[model samples]
Every structure is written in structure tokens, then in C-alpha cells.
Target: MWNTLVSIFPYAIAYTIPMLMTSLGGLYSERSGVTNLGLEGLMLVGYFASAITIKMTEATLGINALPVGLLVGVAAGAIFSLLHAFASINLRADQVISGTAINMLAAALTVYLARTISGSGNVRIMMGIIRKNVPFLSKIPIIGPLFFSQSYWTTWVCLIIWALSWILLYKTSFGLRLRACGEHPSAVASAGINVHKMRYFGVTMSGALAGLGGSVILITYSGEFNGTVAGLGFLSIAALIFGQWKPLGILGATFFFGIATTIANVSQVIPSLQVIPPVFFKIFPYVATLLALVLFSKNSAAPKAIGEPF
Candidate 1:
């Protein structure tokens, strides 16, 4: 039991980070009154942009390209999200429809662009990937194996982002305004706040974070662009709801989902679990997600103006 627990912990962290970041993005957007459901599409653009960048700059940037690729993804996600913001916030289009268009366009566009640029429809890079341990931290007996040994700096970055998000959303004036914009945009605008601009900021940051989320998955685990986020973006939305739209709550929800997700993939690595049908493990996590939503979503509270345009 102890060894199984230790072995599975790191993989859980790998899966959790992306969901954590993307859920945080959704929290920001929804809190600011724009229902930005294009998280899935935004993440795809991020993955494709980062992957293609890494492929092109392998020699020049080397393994350091991971961080650069993430930045590129952030930009790509933000730029693509900007279109949704314009349609929803400026044009006053139905926010869900705008988001769906983004999802549709981003998915098709990335595949076309990736195929055009790579010719073989795959973009991969050898960026001198290496994993290192934290010096003194890894010396700890039980804690080290569960944390420092198998993880990358990306895990720590996600933890820091989660912490910062909590502080930014709950303890800052900007957060107050963002929350206000979602619950009562009229009150915010009447108070002399620029509601439209706030919504734009929220939506843009959401895109950036979701892009970074997708990039983390690529750099930390896959090391290639396979042209899809594999529904992680939608799962992040579920995580946002499961967490009840709070940072700490989202953390807990993503952790559970991440662990559930790993069970199917990691069964081959554990001898005791080898007898279980692969199909059962494959379906388990998704079923769990559905059960979680069905059981918990009705009790969930959302901002009053979440999908409302200013």
C-alpha cells in the first residue's frame, strides 16, 4: 500500500497541474460575467503554437524552449480568446455561441496549421529534456519520493499559481471588482468601474492561463503535439464547478480527477492491478466525472451574471 501510494503520487501531480490552471482561468472569466467556455479550444491553440515553436527553434533555443513555447502558447491562447471577447463583450453576441465558435475554429485551425507547417501532420522536438531533483528537499525520507524526485519545475509553478490566484481573487481590490462584475455588472458600472474592460481582462487572462495549462501537459508529459487536448479543457470546466469556483476547492477537485485519470494509464506499471480489464479503467475516470457533476452541480453556486454580457 505504501509503495503503491508513493509510486502514484507524482503522476497525479502531472495530471493535476493542467486542470488546476485551466480551472483557474475559468474562475476568472466566469467571475467577471463572461461565460468563456472556449477553454478547450484555447488550450488547443496553446498546444499547437507551443509545439510548432519548439519544432522550429529546437537548435536555437534548446531545452530552454519549453518555457518559451509556454509563453508563445499563452500569447496564442490570449489572441484567440480576444476574438471571443470581441464577439461576446463588444458585439453582444450570445456568449455560449461565441465560445462554441472559438472551440470549433481553434480546433480546425490548429490541425490545418500544424499539418501545413510540419508536412507529416506531427510537430515534435528533442529539446534536451532532463529531470532534476531539488537538492536538500529530495533528501527527506517519505516526502522526497512523493514530490521532488519524479516531478518537474512545472509542478511547483502550478502550486505557486494556485496560491497566487487565491490571493489575487480573494484579497485584492481588483478581485473584488471582478467578483462584482460577475454578480452585478450594473452595480460595478454605476460605481464608475469600466465593466466592459474588466470583462475583457478577465477573459484574456483566462485564455492565457488555459494556454499555459495546455503547454504544461505537452512539455511535462507528452513532449509532442498530438493535435488535441483530449478533453482536459472540458474537464477543467468540470473542475471549476466541482471546486465551486474557488482556488482551493479547484485544487482538491483536480487532484481527485488527476488521480482517477492516472489509474487507467498506470495499471500496466503496477503488477497487482494488471488483471483488471483495460476498458474498465479507461471508462472509470469519465464516469466518476459525470457522477461528481450530477451529484454536486445542483448544490453549486455560480455568479449571478456569469453568462450575461455587460
Candidate 2:
């Protein structure tokens, strides 16, 4: 049992980081009164953008290309999210429909572009971020081994981003205004704040972070872009709801789902886990999400004006 736990812990953390970042992105959008259901598509766009960029630059730039690819991915997602921002904020289109359209368009467009450029629907990269120990930190006892050993640098980067996001959203006046936009745009607008601009910032942040999440998957575990994120985007949305739209809550929720997913993926190889059917593990996260939603819906802290066009 100990060995199994130790072996899977790192993988769970890796899986959780991406979802954590993406869910945090959702928090910003929802807090600013925009419901960004297109997180999955935004992530895919980032994933593909990173893949193509890394594929083209790796040979000439070596490992440096990895960071470059990540930047490209972030930029792509931010730019792509403008489509949603325009439709939902300016044109006042139904946010849900616009987000769904983003998903469909991303799935189709990425694959088509991949096939055209590479003659294959998948784009593979030759190198990725290497895992390393945290030196003295890895020397700690129980906590050290589980958290610090064999970790990716991207994990720390994401965590830093998460920490900063919390401070930004909770401690800053700008964050207060953004949150106000979600809860009562009229009130914010009366105060002379640009509700539309704040909402646009929120949506753009979602796209950027979701893109980062997707690229993290590519550079960490997946190392390729195959035109899909295996529904992780929707799962991130679930995490957002499960976490009650808070950064700390998002961390815990995404980690729980990450562990469940890791268990599902590795269940076949672990003797104790194998006793339980793999399907059980596979569906556990989604089931838990549904249960969380049902249990928390009445008391949900979702913005009062969320999904409402300002």
C-alpha cells in the first residue's frame, strides 16, 4: 500500500497542476460575470499551438524552444478567447452557445491544421521538461518524498501562479471591482468602472491560463498534441464548481480529481487497486463532481450576475 501510494503521488500532482490552473482561470471569468465554458477549446488551442511551435523550433533552439512553445501557446489561447469575449460581452450572444461553438471549432480547426502541416492529426515533440528533485527539500521525511521528489519545474510555476491569483483576486482593489462586475455590474458601472473591460480581462485571463494548462500537459506527461485534451477542460469546469470558485478550494478539488484520475489510469498495475474494477475509478471523478454540485448548488457562492450580459 505504501509503495503504491508513493509511486502514484507524483503523477497525481502532475495531473492536478494542469486542472488547477485551468480551474483557476474559470474562477476569474465567472467572478467577472462571464461563464467560460469554452475552457476545453482554449486549452486545445494552446496544446496545438505549443506542439507546432516546439516541433518547428526544437532542432534549432534545443531546450529553449520549450519555453518559447509555452509562450506561443499562452498567446494563442489569449487571442482565441477574444472571440468569446466579443460575442458574449459586445454582441451579447448567449455565452453558453458561444463557448460550445469554441469547443467544436477548436477541435475541428486544430486537427485540420495539424493534418495539413504535419500530414498527421497528431504533433509530437522530441523533448519535454525533465523531472528533478528539490535538493535539500527532497531530503525531508514523509512530506518531502511525497511532494518534492521527482517533480517538474512547471508544478512550482503553476503553484506560484495559483498563489498570485489568489492574492490578485482577493487582496487587490482591481479584483474587487472585477468580482463586483460579476455580482452587480450595474453597481460597478455606477461607480465609473468599465464593466465590459473588466469582464474582457477576466475572460482573457481564463484563456491564457487554460492555454498554459494545456501546454503543461504537453510538456510534462503527454509530449504531443493529438487534437484533444481528453475532456480535461470540462473536468476543470467541474473543479471550479466543486471548489466553490475559490483558489484554495480549486487546489483541493483539482487535486482530488487528479488523484482519482491517476488511480484510474494506474489501477490495472496495482494489485490492491486491481481488486476494484477500473471503470469504478474511471467514473469516480465525474460522479463525485455531480454529487458535489448537487450538494453545494443551494449554497453555491457563484456570482449573482454570472452568465448575465452586462
Model 1 global lDDT (CA atoms, 0 to 1): 0.85
The most accurate candidate by TM-score is 2
Candidate 1: where is the Cα deviation over 4 Å?
Answer: 274-299
Candidate 1 residue lDDT tens string, 1-310:
6899787888888888988899899999999989988999999888888888887777897777878888998899998899999998999999999999999998888889878888866678676335667788988999987778767887888789879888988999999998999999999999999999999999998999999898888888888888888889998888887777888888988888888778777888788888986667556656765777788666746788888777
Model 1: what TM-score? 0.93
Clashing residue pairs in candidate 2 (N, C-alpha, C atoms within 3 angstroms): none
Tens digit per residue, CA lDDT, model 2, 1-310? 8788889999999999989988998999999999999999999999999999999999999999999999999999999999999999999999999999999999999999999999989999999999999999999988888999999999999999999999999999998999999999999999999999999999999999999999999999999899899999999999998888889999999999999999999999888888888888778878887898888887878889999997
- For model 1, state the Cα shift of residue 43 in Å: 0.6
- The residue-level lDDT of candidate 1 at 107 comes to 85
lDDT top scorer: 2
